[model samples]
Target chain A: MNESLFPAPAVALAQADVPVWEAVRFTAEGLVPAIAQQHDTGEVLMMAWMTRETLAETLTTGQACYWSRSRGKPWRKGETSGQRQRVLDVRLDCDGDTLLLLVDQDGAACHTGRRTCFYRAADASGTLATLTEPLVDPEVLYGPGGGHP
Target chain B: MNESLFPAPAVALAQADVPVWEAVRFTAEGLVPAIAQQHDTGEVLMMAWMTRETLAETLTTGQACYWSRSRGKPWRKGETSGQRQRVLDVRLDCDGDTLLLLVDQDGAACHTGRRTCFYRAADASGTLATLTEPLVDPEVLYGPGGGHP
Candidate 1:
């Protein structure tokens, strides 16, 4: 990935008295959507929700942290599955409601162990087709439950 | 830039009796977040909410349509600014909670007349810095009102 496209936010967040998280415009639910994309490949890995706390932590730590709405808790990437993302660049959209992260992915970003969560593509018949198979079994990633929460 | 990464959804949407929009899992608010990216460059254009009606219309017409939460109405991308997006590929994330749309953007994707909505990058101090300027003036894009709703 081109590091020059955007500066890494870790060093930046570390120095800022006024954190970048302050600029984010959270929704009524106090959440914003964050999209993580592979830095070099430009492959979008996943989309997740981030609260201000998670966003601040992510920027400061240079790791991906998100709010798991289903579990009602903070979800740290790679905490369970070891598929962590190293944040290379952080960006806010013009409206400040969305975030884009250029990341160095450790392994498959999907809980299914696929390279990306967006493996199902609309096919020539408007039917969703599975384009990629899981590289690692879910049981292998998340243990007994075999799925992420 | 490769079309082979995913098949174009336009031709596919035209043939299917069971529309792909049905596969989407909208949130409790009856909406799903749709991310538009440049099909060729992999540049993320914008993120917007989509209702079933907007999503269906988009899939069938091969154009981008969204629910304007602010306006509380259906928004055809080019309706106001002529910055339409011709959708090339449609993908659903593993959980069916998000959509990835690969599109050919007509002009600026942001109402600010930037090629993409994500133009501000977090700098070395966690402060956002504008990385790119608007290619077209906002007034030119949206008339005298000067800003999008």
Candidate 2:
């Protein structure tokens, strides 16, 4: 029904599920890289790792879910910062190796309290620019948002 | 020197170089997903794609660049619509596969002329809610500012 964005011909929405083992095929360590992008504008937010369980939960829950390599567990986005993302649509690239997720992000996507974890841009000329300011103060967003900061 | 959001100081600012051909290794398909967010408000904008050359050019040009498979070539952000994005930084995951770009965008990041590509949110009960309106008409942004009817 979303003719404007889809590949056209408007195929019926498939409820097909991507198996877990097949999903984690691309592993850097114990995790596979997952890229998060804004569903509508097509802007990329950040790249994180995801485990089998986390990926399945994300697909089932429709929230932007990821596995934290540092934490060594499945991390539902915004669990700490309250900046959650809800999945809009999920797309698999032609090769079915990389994933394209269309998400409805609640607040900042970056744990640093920035809209995205990508806050720095190193240009071809070797000029690095910080594009956006922190949307929310990290101490506070990561904190209780009450008396932490 | 930028402060590291993570504990590793200066390590985050450390620059790493990637070769062109090996730079982009998409999943099963050649389609590598990219995330886009608002430069000002820290709002997520959209996600697109980038090939090896596009990735190299993007690094060299400092512009938010991508390889549009549909258009079958490199698609520079805002090149056609005047919504150009100036690259602030680019990051790769530990896997050296996926890409993360921080950009200073000009106008609406979305072809729909919205500040970001992501204008939707999921309600508490798990329903997606579209929050904002299109900043610029898609016809205007994609075609001509005033071209489309």
Best by lDDT: 1
Residue lDDT tens for model 1, A1-149:
35533344333323324446777889899999999988777788899999988887887899999999989999999998988899877888888899998889998899988989987777434677666778888788899776565
TM-score of each: 0.88, 0.51
* Residue lDDT tens for model 1, B1-149: 45734444333323324446677888888999999988767787889999988887887889989999988999999888888899877888988899999899998999999998887777535777666778999899889876565
Worst 10 residues of 2 chain A by lDDT: A3-12
fnat, candidate 2? 0.08
Badly placed stretches (over 4 Å) of model 2 are A1-149, B1-24, B144-149
Model 2's alpha-carbon lDDT is 0.57
TM-score for the A chain of candidate 2: 0.78
**What DockQ do the predictions score, one after another?**
0.42, 0.08
- Candidate 1 wrongly placed segments (more than 4 Å): A1-19, A123-126, B1-19, B147-149
Chain B TM-score (model 1 vs. true structure): 0.86
Report model 1's TM-score to 2 decimal places: 0.88
Docking class of 1: acceptable
